[model samples]
Target: MNRRKSREIAMKLLFEISINTNDVSETIENYKENNENFDDVDFAYVENILDGVAKNNEFLNKTIEGNLTNWKLSRISKVNMSILKIAVYEICFQEDIPSKVSANEAVNLAKKYSDDKSPSFINGVIGNIIKLK
Candidate 1:
């Protein structure tokens, strides 16, 4: 699959992990059955995102909460929040992936999966994050 498709899948898997709060391993097993096109790299990205977000949730949420202008973290949709978390993590941690690429992919994902407000909302949060860091 292409990079964008990989990211889309990763976002979906992360969203799944967010909503379910089940064990990651079990969730992956179930997700895998439905994902016929996934490869090891795809799995790595999903696992990295899911585990990284879970590991750094407190810090990430704190950072996001502080950066949001008027919206509370809890007020954000779970799917949009998951997309933002994964994209922001990539921006903050994955030096190899350009911040611009991360931000663009996030906007694209938001446009595809979220409402009209999501792209800008995500872009603002991520822009602030990149600025702060």
Candidate 2:
């Protein structure tokens, strides 16, 4: 199902949605149009991640905020938040995927899309969640 691709698309969409609350549907449509190769599975994954995050944002943030070792949710960059939200959503709700896989994917995304320190920070936060469980 190309989970990595799905995670990337989910992160991108979440970044946009977090910045601009309105026009998320339009944005998703535009993303689909740009990535014509995205099959139904990819589309569904992206949609589910976005929908899940949106529906449980408060809970997700609370989970994330509690897991932070030396940071606050407010201080986290939007890019990191996007990655963390997806990983956290999967860890807490999407029982099919292993927590380690979700966490590693999130760390990879943070490394690619955020600062040098982001990968470790993301890994640590996701790891903390796993420990809490």
Best TM-score among the predictions, by candidate number? 2
List, residue by residue over 11-41, the lDDT tens digit for candidate 2.
9989998888745577799877776676634
For residue 133, model 1's alpha carbon misses the true position, in angstroms, by 1.6
Off by over 4 Å in 2: 39-41
Q: Write the residue-wise lDDT of candidate 1 on 20-122 in tens digits.
A: 8786677778977775756534666667777887888888788788889988888999889888888888887788889989999999999999999899999
**True lDDT of residue 39, candidate 2:** 63
TM-score of each: 0.91, 0.93
Clashes by residue pair, model 2: none
Looking at candidate 1, what is the lDDT of residue 2? 65
Shift in Å, residue 35, candidate 2 = 3.8
Q: Model 1, residue 113: what's the lDDT?
A: 95
Number of colliding residue pairs in each model: 0, 0
lDDT of each: 0.83, 0.89
